[model samples]
Target: MESSSDTFGKDDSADAKLQESRVVTEEEWLQKWETNNIGFHNEQGHPLLKKYMDIFLDGRSGLKIFFPLCGKTIEMKWLADMGHQVVGVEISESALKDFFTEQKLSFSEEPIPGIPGKLLKSTTGNISLYCCSIFDFTSTITGKFDAIWDRGSLVAVNPCDRERLVTIAEIYALLMLRATLRPPFYVPDSEVKRLFGKSCDITCLEKVDGLAERPKKWGLDYFWEVLYMLVLK
Candidate 1:
């Protein structure tokens, strides 16, 4: 007879395969937010970010930081409090509204030229959020970022969109800046090597265990959270 642990392991493996086989669309993500199925949303800034942000800071002040698929994460507020300009791109208008309202930050909205969405700017103009698809991001519009904090944005995207996501990073990242990326799933080092080998140098790659409390699809008690730092070569 199969033990419960064995059954859970099998279920987890099946769930992983299922996720790999499907493409998650923008509308599906919006629905997830609407239903409050956002297990990914962290009320506090991510622990890893709290620990490692100084590496990105490196004695700099007032650096422009970009968060892709930002999703109203408290990390943006934390970054703003650190004296850096926080720019985020999100697709859900509800999430954007919630971010400002919940933070009690006054903001004004205006349309973004050459894009189909509006830009939400905090009263101090230090935090700017573009409500649009990340693919539509352009330097001409948002300008370049001194640093990028991509907490799970890469892993949250469908496999087909991953390459484009990297391209967008390339276009927006400052020449000497480091882009910090965190993947929610198990991303093997070989896969990371394949993706960023040619154009970027990987400065850090660490697998952080026990970071998530929720059981993974395969019912694992904990999953590895991979942190990667990529610098353009």
Candidate 2:
């Protein structure tokens, strides 16, 4: 059931996104952190992440939540603070450091015995951030999760990598994913159905007229923040 504009939910232009075929490299992301060129970086995180917190919890406790391409997101800290374990993967190691340091969470880093990357564990042991590419990550590495919080990961991801992204969030890994679609990475509702419908049941939770509110941000004529709940079928 879809609701209107009060719904909680773009820097890349439609044409630019459409024309760009090369997948964004991990080095580029590292550079974004190094240069502080991350315009999309938000210390506060997505507002809907907090508003929809209950939905993510879904009457559960001690949920192991996953975040793909998590770049120092505040949501992880918030969940960890709430006593849920957070498993996140990102390519930039510095971003992981920033997350722990900025959040004032004490953490220890160690190399994965059989892998090329390292893992940072919060001293309290509720949060684990993987300093590696999302593509190399699996349930085997992070273990299973109860939920997935996908805010910017989908849109920031190249079209080619989407299949892998969706596969990683399969039912075997999590109970559900709250796919919050945002502008600059405008993926329409129809496309969403085509992508997730085969494996998961799709539901539209809310739709907000985001373009009307921030008409100048996306450089586009129209934009809507739509939320989709994808549950394993």
Please give the range of 10 consecutive residues that has the lowest summed lDDT in model 2.
3-12
Superposed model 2: Cα runs more than 4 Å off: 3-22, 180-184, 211-223
Q: Best TM-score goes to which candidate?
A: 2
Where does candidate 1 have its weakest 10-residue lDDT segment? 1-10
Alpha-carbon local distance difference test for all models = 0.73, 0.73
Colliding residue pairs in candidate 1: 12-218
lDDT of 1 by residue, 20-57 (tens): 65677789889978988777787876887777766667
- Model 1: per-residue Cα lDDT at residue 58: 74
Candidate 2 TM-score versus the reference: 0.85
Model 1 lDDT at residue 170: 80
lDDT of 2 by residue, 107-225 (tens): 99898656679999999999998888777776667677778887767777777777887777784354555554454355655556666778877767766665543455646675566
